[model samples]
Target: MPRSRGTNGTDMNTELGIVVAGVSTIYGRAVVRWAAAEAHARHAELRLVTAQPAAAVPDRYLPNDVATAHRAAAVRLLADLAGEMATGWPGVIVTTDLATGPPAAVLRAAAEEADLLVVGADDASPFTEAISGSVPGDLLTTSPCPLAVVPRREWTASTALPASAPVVVALDESTISHAALAYGYAAAARTGRPLTVVRCVTAGSFDQAAATAQARLLIAFGELYPDVAVSTEVEPGDPRHVLVAASRRAALLVLGSRGRGRLASSLFGSVSRDLIRRSGCPVVIARTQPAPVALCS
Candidate 1:
């Protein structure tokens, strides 16, 4: 990915960071539109990427022209999407990259320079491909930055979220959870939305000390983002259930990625998979150093 340049030809990076979106499928188109709106809101550069499957070596059944045509189509798609974003979002620095490779490879390469990678997933569908291998699932494990998995929904005038929708972040006694909290607070502050920090415990047990500790962690972020209205919710139920319910009215649901080992840290555990599959809004997996988390397990 090329770096953005200032008027004096100096290289500069956007504070919100570079946003990469895959734009090859119907779901991907929605993802790009959502990402464009987000990049515009945050004054970030948006890179629209699409990939053409690399040609197989020593193929006798397929002709070269077919591959050429496929590449042509991919080019057209990227150009059209770039044009749409330019028309819709005038000031956003939009760029397009059409790479020759698998869908996952192209997007992951683009994510190397991205602060957040936005992709589309069907909420009603189970992530069977997550285990079997798919783009969003692959990128979820490989993306160096936070991954925003937006559910396919009937968007209102290409608006990703309503004007006043709250940003919800699930928290626990973990450093990664603090990162998630910070991510949520920054998002809320950027969009002028309220913030909700949720902690879930078992049905019959509640630890006031832990709750207090979690609440205390919010003070730093609150001071940093004094304008955002912050609230806390301690719910008695499964973490997935509580967070999904909270997502019903939220603009975005932020969760920390936690586990041990390289593979475990990258993999989305059951709670995150369930939230991504069933949540009422877009679910963002905030990437940070791995840590054990009761809320995210």
Candidate 2:
């Protein structure tokens, strides 16, 4: 049995909300499995959200039949996923909701009270890469909680329970990055993995201010994960480039979905989106979503 408990030993009443978008894609099953497993592990509630065009029928400008068809499709997709999940994990509470808006905004609102938000990595539209306009990319930018980007393949137990793996987290001395750090530490503690914090600075001469910032971030990690082994690195290069390079040897790469400066772009910010597309390991984007009351243990 899974029990939900906060780090501070409180019960969490809210569910671990998963925003499932692009149900028409091949990655749908994988996203469902991953979300179900995570919810089971955390003993959190799971909700499936879908967004469709909301023009009313009959008296409206658009045909209601079109909306009905869309709703039916969403329902079928959820049913298929529910059937698949039930085989492996029964009694898992799953709910479905349909909203009318862009996929990102609809899921974000549905996940308003959720502990974690999950989205598929596929961009259903053609202009995905040029604009980073995919739903997952958009959610990373504006989600109210932590976001998990699931690839189009199920995560095997072997992958989740690797021996002596490293949890790599990128830190930049910002509040968002600190949240990433906190998530990394918690993950490292729960998984019994060593924690490594990497700070990437632009390729240039190292200055005292940069070095001090790096040291402070490392110290914070040390304080957070005192029982676990923690390592720090300060490298000079494009943040994404360095982080992805480091991710090759890591089991998981944790990053902040957004940063403090206006310099960060809209599309998953530059570093996070790049790593998500390129990293060989799983990537967890720590954003400002609702915190779960209890995490299943």
Candidate 3:
């Protein structure tokens, strides 16, 4: 079950909800900064969540005091940074909350009402890699909102594109891919950037049939955003690799979260995960909502 809602309904505001976890790590700090900047721009409130488990407490009470103090120090560090950032971005209100269970599970539950959830890609401890393993994977699979996994070393502080940066959308011959393209086109129009639609066909599969489908998708994309300049490409390689490579040069990688699923409980298909893990640019994972059809008299 999802987390219960708050009575004031402010907790349910999708636009204002963002779950930023793992603030003790460098990657988490990057995510927090980026998310706070975005929240300020969008007039959204930020929620910072940290986790500390009792299992880490030493059996001896004296050592346990030291452990608890360390955890408190880490939390205080994050709170201080968030406070400083909040001062610069007054529109972004930051709240700090602590959870007692697994970090990922706690953060995932909070993501239910969020428009976006941000977390660190790695941490500092030796077991950091192991601890972070399932959190990102599970969140990518089940997060109710879009998830942004910030790499330890980011290219820039802002993921938002420049005024002229092209918006890239990965399109395959699937319903989800088509919806992703539509969302990308709409976003391009909204941001006043040229739209680029990329279709990745396997090297051997790049033939006339694939070309025809690519052309049709391109035409459809153009029709959706007639005012925006649009370009299309049919690359040859693994779709995930091609999309990730292309995303490096593009402003935003717009993609769909739900794809054709052959397995159970697969929130994001294999291709999506690969791109999310490896893409150099910030990715925008659109929810699988049905796009509204154009009405004509």
Q: Which ten residues in a row have the lowest lDDT in candidate 2?
A: 288-297
Note the Cα lDDT for every prediction shown.
0.68, 0.59, 0.60
Which parts of model 1 are misplaced by more than 4 Å? 4-16, 55-61, 123-137, 156-162, 173-176, 203-213, 258-268, 289-297
Q: How far is candidate 2 from the true structure (C-alpha RMSD, Å)?
A: 7.0
lDDT by residue for model 1 over 30-116, one digit each (tens)? 678889888888788888877666566633457978766777887888877887887788877777787766666667788887878
Instruction: Return the TM-score for each candidate structure.
Output: 0.81, 0.72, 0.73
Q: lDDT score of model 2?
A: 0.59
lDDT of 2 at 24: 36
In model 3, what lDDT does residue 176 have?
35
Top TM-score hit:
1
lDDT of 3 by residue, 1-297 (tens): 233332223454354445454455455666677677656655666777666644654546557777678678768876776776677667566766666666666676767767666665445632133234543455655666666655555545444556566778776543335446665777577657788888666534445654565466557667767898987787766776788788777766776656222211132355655565676766666556554443110
Q: Which candidate ranks first by lDDT, i.e. highest?
A: 1
TM-score of 2: 0.72
- lDDT, candidate 1, equals 0.68
Tens digits of lDDT, candidate 2, 1-297: 133443233454554434333343455666666677766655655566666644445325557786567678878877666566656666555655656665666666766677777666543432122114444344665666777765434555225656667888876533335457667877787667888888665644445664565466556556656887888787766776787787777767787644323212232265566666677666777763332332100
TM-score of 1: 0.81
